[model samples]
Target: MTSTFHVRGGRPLKGEITVRGAKNLVSKAMVAALLGEEPSLLRSVPDIRDVAIVTELLKVHGVKVDRDVATGLIRMDPSNVERAHAAEIDAHAGSSRIPILFCGPLLHRLGEAIIPDLGGCRIGDRPINYHLDVLREFGAHVDKRELGIHITAPNGLKGTKIHLEYPSVGATEQVLLTAVRAEGVTELTNAAVEPEIEDLIAVLQKMGALITLQTDRTITIEGVERLGGYEHVAIPDRIEAASWACAALVTKGDVFVQGAQQKPMSTFLNVFRRIGGGLDITDDGIRFFHPGEPLRSIAMETDVHPGFMTDWQQPLVVALTQAEGISIVHETVYENRLGFTSALNDMGARIQVYRECLGGSSCRFGWRNFNHSAVISGPKALHGADITVPDLRGGFSYLIAALGAEGISSIHGIDLIDRGYESFREKLTALGAEYWED
Candidate 1:
């Protein structure tokens, strides 16, 4: 069902909202439970849509999933891991591309795996070619079917060396999930070394897997015969934390985000400080606010790790709309991530998208026909306008814009925001946001 919200603006949002586990890491950690012979326990789990989707997928495969509400713990027992019907998987997955990661662990457990058509946010073209190519190199057979694709390991999976064309996070995760139990040694070049990837590697290590990493984007894994269950507390969601930080800057309010760490968000914190956002870091969390001064403009670029992430640029773009001068942002990760600027333009913000690299750096999309860069001219007052949510991060950006606008904005497709944000409506209410559901 499509959900809509009406947001009354020109008010600051202030209060404390606690964030939970990282969505990118937690769901994959749940999927990693399939490689275990015993029960696995994950703590600080969030009640997000991706986790719900992963839980449903695991249950249909004969894995028992139990959640404890009080302690926020989820125990996944994959002792009876078996094959699931394609129709059931397709029905439960519902636009999530996580089913593809199941091929490796399922092949190791049941000798075959069936995957339905994969879908996700349409911000850009994210093909599964890198994932499939790695699996094929590891001795898996792929057959194309009408509803989906069928993958099987006839002679068992054998680890091999692979060099990724791009540092795709999903493809790197597929390798880690499959290579843990494959025969012999597996070497991966150009692997993603994001914080989520490190968290997954830690969980795998706790389950008795031997994995090694080098500074030069190389990961080596020694396959074992079996793996046991793991007990871990997943890292806090960095993307969500940065989103709230941007929200605080955009609305010119104070918000203390509990469980937000400074280490993972160092790059974002630097940008936030440069843009004249108020920040107070404590042992437990971070407090973000406005300094009652004019917001400054800065030119920035988004890159892989140790750089401003692509997911962080959207809400920050809304904050940038209030900055003094023209702020330029070059999105090097996803080609079409700057598409949300059109809606901002409609809301009276002066945003111009360009096909060239506007941030003075050359990237893969610079030579392509995609509009990968944006110039936001600010100090422009935004009036409320009706807008439909596009993707997850973009949807949250619209919400930020709506709350900071001068009039009431009718925002449709807020359900997309639940895929990443945990208890956002409740948090919004706690933060004194004026909004209603429809």
Candidate 2:
């Protein structure tokens, strides 16, 4: 079933929108439940496609997942895990990065695991080599087969010191999950320090795992014989919050984003304020707008945690198009993320993509046609046009662009947006957006 959104443009969105759990964290937390010996309860779990994917994957692994539609609560019991059905597993193998996380938990509990290829944002060649290397360090033998990844723990899995070449989020999580149950202590250096990673660690620690976060980028986990269940409330969706903040900027509207944490979004809020955007932050939420000032252009570069997030770049670029001067964006994360700018160009945005890294910075997408840098010359009038959303965040940027355009826009593949955004249509309607199903 395909769903499309038809949006009539030229509306200034005004309202308070609350964001649910982080999509990036919920799926990983679901996989983390496999480490438990009993049932685990997760609160603030959003009813998005990715969560559904993780739920179906967990159920196929012989675990029962009970979701409360009213409260957004998820209860997972992995005590009776069986070998996940091959056909069902293979069908969603390439669906998201969360599946690869099963390699550690499955191998630990069942002595073997077969994980299908992973799928997520098409920003670069996201290889699981780091994951495989970390698992091998933990005494697991990994083999690549025609169907999927075959991982076996013949020696029953022993912990070892594992150092990541890069602070890849998936790789760091894989090491933590696999090493926690091994025979000896595991020391992981160069770990990804994203807030979601910290949240995952909290969950693991609550399950009776002994973990220590030392300064100078080192994490030590002492192997435990068994792990108990945990109840955790997932972190608020910062990506969703930033997306709505950009929506407020592009439409020149006032939006109060509840459930947005200020600490995790300091970098984004700093950048937003630097570009003549106004924000009022409280302990619980943030309000974004521009009060009595023309929007300015600012240079931004994406980095890991505590830096400008690459996912926030797309929607902000749409807002930057209306700024008076040239705004430069350097994406250092996924290489192919800049492709969506071409779709914005079709809607009369003056954006030029560059293959070579600009602003004296290096990036993962610098060499490929990924176009690591984008220069937006704006204050140009944008007319509504038909566009396709290729990924989750990019889909919302299209919606923001459509809202700021004149006339109407027909956006296809809106189901992709629902993978992350919860109650998206209802939220837009409350914000005074004119949209309908077709």
Candidate 3:
């Protein structure tokens, strides 16, 4: 069951918290370990629900998974991989989409994979059809069963060309993991080039996959007959790093986010600076603080990689609640991302959701029934309220709202936050946040 957090607000969180591996990549990286013939070592793995879920799923399939939580080092062995029953797989799948991606690796080893239906954050419509489509292009026969998805490659998987209608990260990953082992050459047009995808590519390359990156978001992979293992360190969680930074801005606090990188966060930092957030960045990490003055509001848009991330939208929106003047946010990635603003409005943030496009170029959601844009008129004094956490990113955003509000806030479903943030309660305590779990 999910727990509740009672937070006494209006406290400036101080001190430091370290960010570990990217939650987005680490789980998939563990899945990639199944493609290897020998043991693979992944370092800087975070202690999170996704990792734990993926670990248990892999273990159910007879993959030997071992980890040192203190050091964030994980060693995965796929030498004796076996097929897990649907019930076994479904029990471990618990609220993670990683199970679908496992079909590619499992079809290669066991010739068939029964994956439970997908489930995760309810941010928007994230259909698994894209993954299914990519797998079909690679010669895998899929049968939709009552309980789960059944996939097989009776003739053995073979590579083929594919063009995505949308450059989805999960679909691109499905192509990469499957293509690396299929026969002949595979070329994917309009593939997602997120930093996490790049990191996964690096891991696959370390396992003897021949892959090529083109200038125009095209990836070509030459299937190899056999593959070995790899030892590598994962990139830090850019999303988490930016979240803590947003917390600092919202609560008028100071925080040193260790292990936060600069390259992946350049776009977010630029926007953060324009919004009147103070920062002292270094080779080690970034120290985010309040400007000690009024925070300025600005117009921003969430986009694909090398642009502002959609995941960074919620927490930063809470920070925007403290800024003077109106802030416009155009969420081009997810159609319903602005839905979290309802709770913030209850806490005194004046955010309005719109069905029409605002602040940026037109997107796929425009001219539709979906409310994909938002306008926040801020410098509003936030008061505490009873709220339930929604999704991973949105849950953390609620904590930021609670910390900036006056009086006590009763927040439930905080365990959802553990799906991404590692040891957040301890980190909150270290930062002097007056909160207790019940």
Name the 10 consecutive residues with the lowest summed lDDT in model 3. 89-98
lDDT of each: 0.92, 0.86, 0.93
In model 2, state the lDDT of residue 330.
Answer: 87
Query: What is the C-alpha lDDT profile of model 3 across 255-323, one tens digit per residue?
Result: 999999999999999999999898899988999999799999999899989789999999999999999
Candidate 1, run of 10 with poorest lDDT: 63-72
Please estimate how well model 2 matches the true structure, expressed as its whole-model Cα lDDT: 0.86
Candidate 2 pairs with clashing backbones: none
Residue 266 CA displacement from its true place in model 3, Å = 0.4
Q: Is candidate 2 or candidate 3 better by TM-score?
A: 3
lDDT of 1 by residue, 1-438 (tens): 649889998889899999889999999999999999999999999999999999999999999999875576999999999888899999999999999999888999999999999899998989877778889999999998997889999999998998888888899999999999999999999999999999999999999889998899999999999999999999999999999988888888999999999999999999999999999999899999999999999999999887788999999999999999999999999998988889988999999889999877799998999999999998889889999999999999999999899999999899999999998999999999999977
- What global local distance difference test value does model 3 have? 0.93
Error of 1 at 140 (Å): 0.4
